[model samples]
Target chain A: MNLALHDIRHNVSRFVLTAVGIGLLLMIVLGMSGIYRGLIDDALVVVDHIGADLWVVQRGTRGPFAEISRVPANLEHRLRAVPGVASARTFVSHNVQREHLGKPLRMNVLGLAWPEDKGEWVNLIAGRPLGQPHYEMIADASLGLPLGEKLALGKDTYTVVGITRGMVASSGDGIAFLTTRDSQAVQFDQSGEAIRLERAARVQRVRVNDVGRIQPSFIERGGGPSSSIPALASPMVSAITVRLSPGVDPAAVAAIIAAWPDVSVHTRDGQEQLLAYGMIDKARRQLGLFRVLLVVISTIIMALILYTLTLDKIHDIAMLKLMGARNTMIAGLILQQALLLGALGFGIAWYVGGFVFPKFPRRVLITPDDLWGLAGVVVLISVLSSLLGIWKAMRVEPNTVLS
Target chain B: MNPPPDNTPAIEVFALTKTYGSGNTEVVAMKDVSLRVAKGEVIALLGPSGAGKSTLLTAMGLINPPTSGRITIGGRPVLDGPKPLVDLRAFRRHHLGFVFQKANLIPFLNAVQNVQVALEINDVPARAARRRALELLDYLGVADRANNLPSALSGGQQQRVSVARALANDPNLILADEPTAALDSHRGRQVMELFRKVAHERGAGVIVVTHDQRSLDVFDRTLEMEDGQLKSSQKPD
Candidate 1:
């Protein structure tokens, strides 16, 4: 007669309430899994979208995301001149927090090598890609920057020409794209006071040196502009991204560049691996630990609940036993109830997670594999948890019904 | 209805003894108990609290094995001195029925389902078992409460359902341990009369243990137990 279902039907309110409590706990576990997946996805999103064949960073550095990397801007020209190199672009990225609409806005400012690559690969949902790269910017929708909105930073004011969706950096901050020079201007930006102090110090150095007296033009130009000076080198880039021509092997080109004294070269897959394992490994482990702990806690709670339920029906169990019910029949009652509880809880988690995940500050991506894996875990937990109740039931003596 | 011949015994227990503990803490709950009940006979086991009536009843019910004895039901030996002659559980499922003091219905199941489960335990097909359950409920005059859970029924109505469940498998022997303990005098007499009707109509041997002397007239014979022994047996006047 399906005694387990019959019992639940008799006490439906309590069963449903208990399932809801368990469902919420399961939701947190599911959310942890989703957040862990999201972390890896967020870390690799830019690397995948850039579609570079090779990355050339500063020598002896993992950069540009895992550590600091700075190569001269002219490295792009040098990379383009190499055999089998289809195209090369200077890559620059740095995080910036600026005030907009009386609130702090944080973003990863990424430089697009303009006139050659204008962020046409970005998943733009509104407006167009960077048409005029100087003062035009493509901002992610997460930054709350609408198309055509103007944002002032450093000495330049940029108008948002396009808005992208779900384009976040490894740190979970939205990205804003600008031309290489503008991004460099933002990266090395200094306050007027700091600039004046730096220029004065340069003039003083020139005055105190014997070479400055011999060459008066050096002192005069030192106060004019840092860029115009012959002694000062050009601004540096974070890395140089390279695209290889058809039938060209990236390893051969990378091996050639690896011998260079001033730069370290990496294939695209190598860069992605470094970013995933080297950057977000610890966070992934932490989330995995939390998920395991939660599953354990869930199993314990379900065990106690099933045990108490069996205790409540101890008399009924005795009567059934005296009536010659086999051990399997009684055990099936508890086991089926546990399975039903787990099934109900999982259904609730999946339904409610749909509404709750998108609202999280960071991306919560529940993949099909994660769903199937959690379902398997829940079934295993239900079976393990029902053991306590079944043990108690099997020990009930039929003579107790007489007493 | 015609009564079966005395030669046809539904159950026979020989020299049954049950004890608990050992040495200094040894306690005899029942000793050297022997009895025989014929088909179509309704008898009562009357005694005070702790008088070994329930001990003997449980032994006869095959739930608690005796320290020593032979128990045969429906002319087949089922237990000998705690050693089982056949599969005891299967024997109980097919050959015996029991009604406890409080009706002891599985609270979750409705009246008919409670009865249907007994037949199902004996491997009866569900559809036929349900039909038999409803027929038994109707015979006990509780068919209208077939869909009602135990809690929803009155005490008297629940007992009727319990009796209906006992008859579901058409068992040869039915045992009752103070089956009317929770009912009023009138309702208790009604339950006792229903047991008599079940015995006479179905030819099942019925043994009811009770402390109520008012329902003595409903049984054809009565046995009294005291200090773990059968002290007397008499046919009711």
Candidate 2:
């Protein structure tokens, strides 16, 4: 006659309802951990996939993810010339929002250095990688764009040549890969009114200047939009990603690059660390605090609930004591009920989370370690919470059964 | 029902005193109380409210230890004054049973489980304990209500299950405090008569502290208490 189980059987509805309430609280706790893990994974997804041995950004900046970074597009040539550097590709990314299917569609547009790097490393699940540079793009499946779908942006329409999955930026937006020149064109695209104003201002400045007066054709040549001048320098990229040759020491090459005054250099791991710790450190702390507060709240609620349950059984406890039941038996009754409640609640959270987590807008990634760690916490909370009930039970005098 | 031999007494308490609050506010709940009960005998302790009949009953049951004096059960000394000679809880589990004013059945447990728990707490094997619980409930004539929780059973039926639980360990001495207070006259007398039958047939010495005088004839002897002391003792006619 397991009294704990028998008692639960008698009040199963209330017990299960109580467990469900606790389960929902536990779900939030687990969800917090999962969301944090997903945040880190989302932050590092591009960094892990880029296959870069080193990153060269603007001097003293953490970028291209944690902060703004800009380097001359031709820096790729300089990086490739360095000893031990096998190849260098220009990296540029910026977020853009456009109306699609009457809903706001946001994406992080990443410029792939074409001819040398044509997004071949992207895990394409549908269609082919960029075959034509300017008018073709590879997009993450999360953008809800199917293969061959054409998206019009900045006076140009790009056909989706390929689709990938799980490729998202730190901001949780889907990523789209386009040629470096096309991306730069889109990033620096100006409205017709702004372009007209800029042209008028350049013409007025040329009329007022001595060089413009002496060489009137110079105004037409130099004042024209920079894109019309093919000999001018190229647009800036966010950073430069370098792949090291086999047997080349990344640290030695990085040290050499670090000596240059124009840019900062970082190993691949450093970029990941900067993204995880620098970009989302406050969010992590906030989530961790919420998790701690929730656990404490859960412990308090369970303690009060168990204490009330013990109070309800006061007379029965006295009767059992008078009937010569040992103190351990009485304590076991409360302790076992607490443990069972925790186990049932955790089971509910685990089972229901499987269905609920996928529906969240952001990924809720529950790892095996997270599951095991939460289970251990639940057990510890149950044991600690039952202490109030056990104390109350032990204080009940057996003579209370009299009269 | 097997009868025990007459020579050995089931329980004996000598000059037992129980008091509450130490200095200045001292209140004696039981004073200089001494009595003996033989096996196969049922005795009733009668008193008004606050007369300490319950105090004496609880003291004799080994639930509330007396402040002073001695207690012996089955010819073995168990308590000398307030101190215990043996492991009191272990001894009580094996040698004594108790019934309260209310059925006091653990509400979550069915009647049989309520009875079975008593045996289980004594380290009795579950199967054997369950079998004995069923037998005791059947003997008490509440076998049909074995699967029902206490709330679902009638008051008389609940008391019968309570009695069965007390007898589950086959204890030598049973103490009941106002066991029939919640039942009507007919049910009250029935519960009292059940106690008498339990005592005479099972050879257990039963002491019942009750306010109801109508069931006096069901006991082998009656003891009256007043102002925390035994005022009189008489064999029932």
State fnat for each of the candidate structures: 0.76, 0.83
**Listed models, DockQ each:** 0.83, 0.77
Top of the candidates by DockQ: 1
- Predicted structure with the largest lDDT when compared to the true one: 1
Top TM-score: which candidate number? 1
Tens digit of lDDT per residue, candidate 1, span A180-254?
989989989999989988998998999899978999888887787788887799989999999999999999999
Q: What interface RMSD do all candidates show, one decimal each?
A: 0.8, 1.3
Off by over 4 Å in 1: none
lDDT of every model, 2 decimals: 0.92, 0.90
Tens digit per residue, CA lDDT, model 2, B150-193: 89999899889989988988888998989888999999999999
Q: What are the clashing pairs of model 1?
A: none
